[model samples]
Target: MKYLSDQMLIEVYHRAVDLQLDSAFIELLRSELDHREIRIAQVSA
Candidate 1:
């Protein structure tokens, strides 16, 4: 996650949502976003 750029993270997040991935996995992405202090306007997972 540290190696991924912010844009990459955002892309992965969108993909996760689109795929309807597991909630726990999505939560990890959300956690990374929080760690980076990035705020997403909304999340539908």
Candidate 2:
């Protein structure tokens, strides 16, 4: 699960950087990533 989460984060980061998403969209993606990380931590705990 941790590995998958890390992979997802990397993908999101790449998309944000490579695609040059607008600030608003990037912020939204960051929010989603934060939520995913929280969920993963909860599940792991």
Candidate 3:
């Protein structure tokens, strides 16, 4: 679960940069990435 979410976050991040996604969509992705990062940190810690 963690790995998949992390991979998705990376993919979305790249897509946001490479494709120049809409600001709202990018913000949504950023929020998702933030949540995923927190989850990953908790799991690792």
Candidate 4:
């Protein structure tokens, strides 16, 4: 297996969202993960 960088992962994620590759239910889950990551610095402070 190969590892993808955060940027690559985000790009792929966005592409998936654009294409509606995942079911409707998964979009919220993906949003939550992105939210958690964006809030990491605030949480650590």
In terms of lDDT, the best-performing candidate is 1
| Stretches of model 2 off by over 4 angstroms after superposition | 1-13, 38-45
TM-scores of the candidates in the order shown: 0.88, 0.47, 0.59, 0.47
Across 1-45, the per-residue lDDT of candidate 2 in tens digits comes to 245565677576557656777777766656666867633222110
Q: What is the lDDT of residue 43 in candidate 3?
A: 19
Backbone clashes in candidate 4 total 0
Which structure is stronger by lDDT: 2 or 3?
3
- Candidate 2, backbone clash total: 0
Backbone clashes in model 3, listed as residue pairs: none
In model 1, pairs of residues that clash are none
What lDDT would candidate 1 get against the real structure?
A: 0.90
Top TM-score hit: 1
lDDT of 3 by residue, 22-44 (tens): 77776676677787663332211
Model 4: how far residue 33 lies from native, Å: 4.9
User: Roughly what TM-score does model 4 have, to 2 decimal places?
Assistant: 0.47
Runs of candidate 4 exceeding 4 Å displacement:
24-45
Give the per-residue lDDT of model 1 (tens digit) for 1-45.
Answer: 999999999899989988999989888998999999999878665
- lDDT by residue (3-42, candidate 4, tens digit) is 6555655665566666667555345545554764732222
lDDT, candidate 2, at 18? 65
Looking at model 4, which ten-residue stretch has the lowest summed lDDT? Answer: 36-45
